[model samples]
Target: MSDLYIGLMSGTSLDGVDGVLVDFSSVQPRVLSHATQGFDDRFRAELLQLNTSGPDELHRAALAANELARVYALVVKRLLETTGTQPAQVRAVGAHGQTVRHRPQQFDGTGYTLQLNQPGLLAELCGMDVVADFRSRDVAAGGQGAPLVPPFHQALFGQLPGVTAVLNIGGISNLSLLNASGAGSLIGFDCGPGNALMDAWSQTHTRQAFDAEGRWAAAGTVHAGLLQSLLSEPFLALPAPKSTGRDLFNGPWLQAHLQSFAHVSAQDVQATLTELTAQACADSLLKQAPDCKRLIVCGGGALNTHLMSRLRALLPGCDVASSAVHGLPPLQVEATAFAWLARQCLERQTGSVQSVTGARGARILGAIYPA
Candidate 1:
């Protein structure tokens, strides 16, 4: 028997929500339907504000949670209508929620990561079981609770008989190194900024949300010196099994790196930032998984032609291509992974790799909320 599952994701980009319908059975999983819903400008601004703003923003987060739950429900409804699936037929929905703040190693005793999602509201509205709060458990187990896509990557792309590196360039970049020998041989970690830096720079200068196709970056010249300075960030040198988010890649972090180049053209800075991402990613690959033969790119950054070209140049001698080459769209991989994860939860199986997360042992992720 096949099980239908909906996976909802809203990453650090604050761009939108991705809802995917997946059909899973004992054999394999397939994408049944998909939808992308954009967040309004006001809500986006509020979410960014909540990232840095204090206690008062909690109320705003609550309101945004409700609004996002509504959006998730709407997307699921559309997905079900198009796929001819019903709430009763669908097994569950995996909601990633909105990550507001992630301080994995806070100075305070209460190290925490916060994702603003009202699962009760989502379950109530969608009339389906919801599995969420996917991160905290890993953290409690002494893991970074991120780059959670490695196990799914292993499940999907572990057929070949060599080392395969799956790179996800979301708001922050991450990598999953899968050894075809077996499922437990996977290793993963966050590899610094992806579109987050470029998007932030683009918005600050051109008043645009993102640099389309990285055209703005292509138009400008890369400042080698600036690129060197940006790459010098300590986070780049951090060891594996680590994860980072907007908290470490936000406005203030950019400001600290912006020196006498305040007068530099915004496009030029964007170009340098783009190079920063590609260079850091390549550097990490060379250092950590030097034996990798194939690099499969996914997430929003895969669509940036300029970035793709940079990666090819930097990672010469390796086959660098989009996940599409292997049957997954760059944009939908994460959402699709969540669908697979929800299936794991239902089966009482471990969804995260201990090597990737540094967990003492494999653990079944996500808390379930029934309709």
Candidate 2:
């Protein structure tokens, strides 16, 4: 018996969607096929707009959702066509729609997070079961509704006989600590800005999407004063069960930090931002899981060469490397996670454990829309 699922992820970067066709036939799941589809500049702009305030947002967002589904369907079509798989053969598709807003910390009773998606529309378009909205249930249960990948990380990398921490550095960074000692529960939390600040700065000055290989950052010296001020942000000191997105660390936020360092060159600001991500991650590990010497780094940041060097330098004696060294590439890890999540939902299994997200207990996450 073979259980196949396709995972679609539109991460906080808003650059594109990653789709993977996975086969769960043996103990170790196999990647049958995978592909990426970048959003057109116009579509990307609209998505960025929805991330913040805009007029006629209701109508614009609806149109964007439809376009998103259409684009996702294209990715799915390619994944299946290339792999010779079919929607009927696959059990489901796990789609993580773009997160326009995430404010799980607002416990004043009016807090809500939004990931723009039309799962039902997706199901209809793909003719396959779709599992989406994996965050809300955790929020409803008094959890941060993020870093949801920790449980999935546990499933993938937990067997290693030590404190194995998987670091995901997407738009924001998060740590998933798999303690093979003591209770053996997985601990997860956001570590703060990952590539967001650097990416924004790079786009502003170089007109590049991101600082490829961290070259620009490496060319400049770190502005210690600016780095210190950025490090002072209170969110970095918060306890676990926290999550953040562009909502907190957007362009305006970075501009405010840069306003204080008027004389610093753009490259220095970029370098400092890179240092900020590395330092923040190191701080989290040293503070929480000092024994975690083995880290599996993933997401867009892992590909940044200089950032990897910074991480290795800041955290002495720790073995730092991309997820590729551990059976999955940096980009494939998250999309594959949702594929596992979809399979879990189908089996009525608990998708997340309490320790990871501060939920009440292990609960089945996400809603299923049948084709």
Candidate 3:
């Protein structure tokens, strides 16, 4: 059998879908091809709306999921076509599906984390087996059900001589701590908000999808008062094995914080928000992995030069750089990780780490839809 797989990821930012065709026959999986398809403004808005409660949300959620599957299928087609590979030659497609709600260990004590995806539909559309719902199993095992990329991070960067960290700043920020020892020393968790707040603020004030290299924030001044208010969010102080999404850091939450600072300029708020993200991430590293010597950043936020600079400034002890310098580009890291996870599922191997998610034990994740 061929060791080819496809990985699709559309994160909390709702930016778009990223797909990768990977060949895993070798020790280091090689990314055969990569493709991205951005969501139209209308679709992006709908996905964002679906994050909160609304009338007939059950029906709306179902339709949105189907649409997401279609989008995933389109990306899969592009990956296969770009690589000139046949679907039958691929083992499986790991679809992370857009996370609409993520509140683990809440309410019922076994709180569910919902991701919008119709994997069976994706399997049918692409003629490939699909592996998805990767978080639920971990949650059921009494875990945070997030920061699933750590094991993959260990696979890619664990051999370094000291404590190394991988920070993926999507809509939410997550950190993977890898010590030189091995998997026994790995730990990972969601740090806090990443691009979600800044993206929302930019769309509201500047009518742009994002700050574009965080230029809007770069042009503004950071407001000390507003920065303090934003940092006071309780999630930022939560202990490890914690994960969060739009549920805690949405527009309403920001608006509530802003009610106390009506005089703050829009640009200053943008700068302050950028600082909030940088500070949250830096604080997490300093607190949890103070020995970390290198921080390899990945995901959409990695493209924000201003955010990158803020991180570098905050963590004066560490050498911060993009994941591109470490072999994979920022955008490709998560997708490639999912590809690796799918392979683990097929092999009946454990994917989640016990130390990272606080699960009872490591478990093979994801549900497979055979082709």
Name the best candidate (by lDDT).
Answer: 3
RMSD of each: 1.6, 1.2, 1.1
**lDDT (Cα atoms) of all candidates against the true structure:** 0.87, 0.89, 0.93
> Could you tell me the TM-score of candidate 1?
0.96
lDDT tens string, model 2, 1-371? 45999999988887899999998887887898989999887898899889998999989998898889988999999999998886799999999898998987486753778988988888988999999998888888877788889988988888888889899999899999887445477889999999887887898899998999999999999999999999998999989778888988888887787788899998999999999999999999888888777989999999999999999998886899999999999999999999999899889998887787777777888899989
- Flag regions of model 2 displaced more than 4 Å: 105-107, 180-183
For model 1 the local lDDT of residue 370 reads 92
Which model is ahead, 1 or 2, in terms of TM-score?
A: 2
Per-model TM against the reference: 0.96, 0.97, 0.98
Candidate 2 least-lDDT 10 residues: 104-113
Candidate 3 weakest lDDT stretch, 10 residues: 178-187
lDDT of 1 by residue, 1-113 (tens): 45888888889888888889987764556788889988888888888888887777878899988988998888899899998887899999999999988976466633678
Model 3: lDDT of residue 63: 92
Q: How many steric overlaps are in each model, in order?
A: 0, 0, 0
The prediction achieving the highest TM-score against the true structure is: 3
